[model samples]
Target chain A: VDAGALDAARSRDASLTKPPGSLGQLEDLAIWYAGWRGERPKLEAPQILIFAGNHGVTAQGVSAFPPEVTAQMVANFNAGGAAINQLARCFGARIDVHPITLDRPTGDFTEGPAMTEAELLEALSLGWAAVDPAADLVIAGEMGIGNTTSAAALAAAMFGGNPRDWVGRGTGVDDEGLARKAAAVAAGLARHRGELLDPLEALRRLGGRELAAMAGAIAAARSHRIPVILDGFICTAAAAVLERIAPGALDHAIAGHQSEEPGHARLLGALGKRPVLTLGLRLGEGSGAAVALGVLKAAIACHSGMATFAEAGVADGPG
Target chain B: VDAGALDAARSRDASLTKPPGSLGQLEDLAIWYAGWRGERPKLEAPQILIFAGNHGVTAQGVSAFPPEVTAQMVANFNAGGAAINQLARCFGARIDVHPITLDRPTGDFTEGPAMTEAELLEALSLGWAAVDPAADLVIAGEMGIGNTTSAAALAAAMFGGNPRDWVGRGTGVDDEGLARKAAAVAAGLARHRGELLDPLEALRRLGGRELAAMAGAIAAARSHRIPVILDGFICTAAAAVLERIAPGALDHAIAGHQSEEPGHARLLGALGKRPVLTLGLRLGEGSGAAVALGVLKAAIACHSGMATFAEAGVADGPG
Candidate 1:
């Protein structure tokens, strides 16, 4: 972050026609964006990256949808027929689909590692290289059958909690399916116990390819000075690995919304992120973040476009 | 609201590509919009009306800014130089400014009734006539210095509460200013003791022209079948008059954001409204609601634009 730009933006925010700090969190958001971009920044291009990969845990009956739904959703995304596509178009964000070999599902973590070292590295690189260098803002989303179960297992491994605490009904599963999700998470934890100490190893053992890709995309956004908006539980869990490995790794990112998922609020608390919206959004594929982009745009628009009290001939002093 | 349109929209939402209830509150927002508009709704024209008035209570030192700032800011809004203008321009909303006799300040409620019946009726008619009947959505904002003090008093009169419970720092008031606000609210409550039972009487006795105008505009929106996004503290307090007079009078409206004003949360609880955004916005120019318009747009877009499962050739059954 540019300290000088941040200071400059703060000074400018106070001079706007409204009272100082009346805009609340928007003042901080605009200043933060100014720190990354220039003092008078504009959000011209925001990119939405949706990474899709099948999770082998679907075999464990951890999700309500079948594994092939991942590929079908990916095709739907490519054809501009998905929820994320509608959100992206609504917000004028460029949508990109990155499928990390959807035909080849990750290895079942309960039986073994979710991904081999080479496979994890390849997925990460794919995510890193997919980011648009000129984009001013980025949002990484995921589409994977049974991925929420994988996210719960990975979060429990990294953050340390009971499997049931992290598990949620993905795609509207029944009670029996929820129990299977918890059991699979517990088994994955037991299988990858020692390896969980290292965040990267834990991610490789329990997180899916799309999850790894989201982590990579978030890191890549930081390098490009593009502010990132973290989506729901699966996306946040993916990015959590980076924060665990290095403190302040996600300083460039903010949680987009607190989803209806049980573990999302806890994960956001651990990350020390206050979500921009709390609309009870639970769908993945970056829909929440895409929706939140409008807020960031409004913040920037007001910060940059509104005239100062001096310019507007408006009084700005206490009575 | 059209019941048939709402039911049809709900069924259509279930058949969308995403899982049921995955979009959370967004699904409900879209359905509500459809109920007001039709089975397929489009938010092409969102109208924002900003009513500005002066208050005699400024003599009591209840607010941080002077009364002249209201007219000055109203001019700024007219010149398209204020925060609300920026937001309206960003979201494609038509901005209308209604200065309800800004030259004549309302009588101080601490001494006597804020307005006579004729004055109250004139303000209400101005607000009622200001709303464009063709607008699909409407937002009412205000620019009245010392109006928060009036809001607190009116809220206390409508909903039983101590003066201190409803008072907050309006536009960054000092501790001394806050004390004056509470005292003013207490004085007004005592002065308007017996005649506060009727909601309209309470509004006339304690509320300013801008507040009464907001109430009128909200009531007018309901008659026109236009959905409304209620703004922050002062706006909500203004609209509460209608809701108090007739239960469910605010069914056409949803809170746009929870303001930083201390009384807003308590008022929202009484009204049974959950704000769409909780960004701590305390700016009363309908800026929060203008920003939330994007979220509403996204909800309607996803609800009306996404391909259904069978339409998109995607399987949709429990595993």
Candidate 2:
């Protein structure tokens, strides 16, 4: 964050026709943009990146949907026929679909490491290469069956909590499926308990390809000076890994929404991020991030377009 | 609320590519729109109506800003130089400013009724007349200096709460000013204790002309078949009075955002309304409502534009 830009944004907000701090979080959003971009931020040329990968953990019967649904949704995204595509179209953001293939399906982390270090690196590079430097804002989303289970496992491993506390129904699973998912997460944590303390090792052992790719995308976006808006639970869990591996990696990231997933709030809290929207959203095709772009743009418009008290000849409140 | 449209909306949501109830509150918003309009809702023509009035409550030294700021802001709104104007522009909504004048600034509510019954009716009619028949969605906002004091008094009078619990700083008031505002609310409630049980009487005695007009506009919008979006605390306070005066008047309304005012949550709760956005906003003048128009439109666009499961060849989830 740039101190000068933040100071300038605060000064601008105070001069707006409304009372100081009257705009509330909207004012803070503008200041965040200024600090992130080191200038008055414009939300032009925003892009959405959806990373898809098959989760080997799906073999554990953790999700209601089949693993093939990940590929099907990726194709759905490519055909402009998914929720993310529609949201991007509505919000005027370009959409990119990146499909990451591991050496094979991750080795079912309940029994062994989800992916080898080489495979995780390959997935990360794929996510990194997906970033478009010219974009002003980048939103990272994910599509993977059983990814929520993977996310929960990763969150538990990173934060050291009980698996049941972090597990939630993925794709509207039944009670039996939720129990299986929780059990799988606990098994995965136990299998990799030694390596789980290290964030990168946790990604290799307990995280899916898509989660790794999203963390890489976050790092790539930050390096490219493009602020990233993290999608729902799965995307945020990926960010949690990034933050652990690299301190302050999430400084350029914003939590788009509080997901309906039970662990999302705990994950976001650990990341020190406040979601821009909280509509109980849990769909993870970057839909939450895409919808939040409307708010970010409105905040930017107000920050840039609103007339000052002096300009409007409106009397200021008592100092 | 129309039962048939709501049923249709639910069916439509299920047919969409996403899982049932995947879009979270957005699904409810679409259903609300359908029920409000008695058909599929189209957000093509949205209009924001800002009702500004002066409050005699300012005479009690209950506000941070002077009473004239209300008129100044009305002028600012008219000049397209206010936050509401900028927001309306951002969301592509037509903005109308209606300034209401009382015979005097309704006698200080602490001393006497804010307005005579006849005057209150006239103000309501002014608000009613401001609603544009062509608008598909109507957002009602209020601008009145010291109005928060009036709002708190009205809320306490109708809901039987302590004035201290309802009163808050109107626009960055200091500790002394907050104390004064609470004292004024308590005084106003005492003066109107007998008549306050009747919601209409509460408005006449403790509400401002702007609030009366807002309630009128809400009733008018419902009759005209235009869905209404209620702004922050003051606006919701007006709707509370409307809901009490005419049962189901708020059936057509959506709470736009939770205001920072402490009394706002209780007021909306009393009306059985949940605000769509919660950004700690208290700028009023329908700014929160205008910003929310962006989210509403995106939801509408998604509801109307997204391809269905059959159309997109996406398999439905297991029931």
Q: Which residue runs does candidate 2 get wrong by more than 4 Å?
A: A102-104, B38-40, B102-104
lDDT of 1 at A56: 84
Tell me the tens digit of each residue's lDDT in model 2 across A59-95: 7888777776676677788888777776887678999
Q: Write the per-residue lDDT of candidate 1 for residues A1-319, one digit (tens) a residue.
A: 8899999999999999998899999888999999999888999899999999988888899888888788888989999888899889887899989988888999999999999999999999989998999999999999999999999998999899899999998789999989999999999999887889998998899999999999999999999999999999999999999999999999999888999999999899989999999988888999999998989989999999999999998889864
Instruction: State the TM-score of the second chain for every model.
Output: 0.99, 0.96
Interface RMSD of 1: 1.2
The TM-score each candidate achieves on chain A is 0.99, 0.96
In terms of lDDT, the poorest run of 10 residues in model 1 chain A is A310-319
Colliding residue pairs in candidate 1: none
Which residue window of length 10 is worst by lDDT in model 2 chain B?
B310-319
Here, model 2's chain A TM-score works out at: 0.96
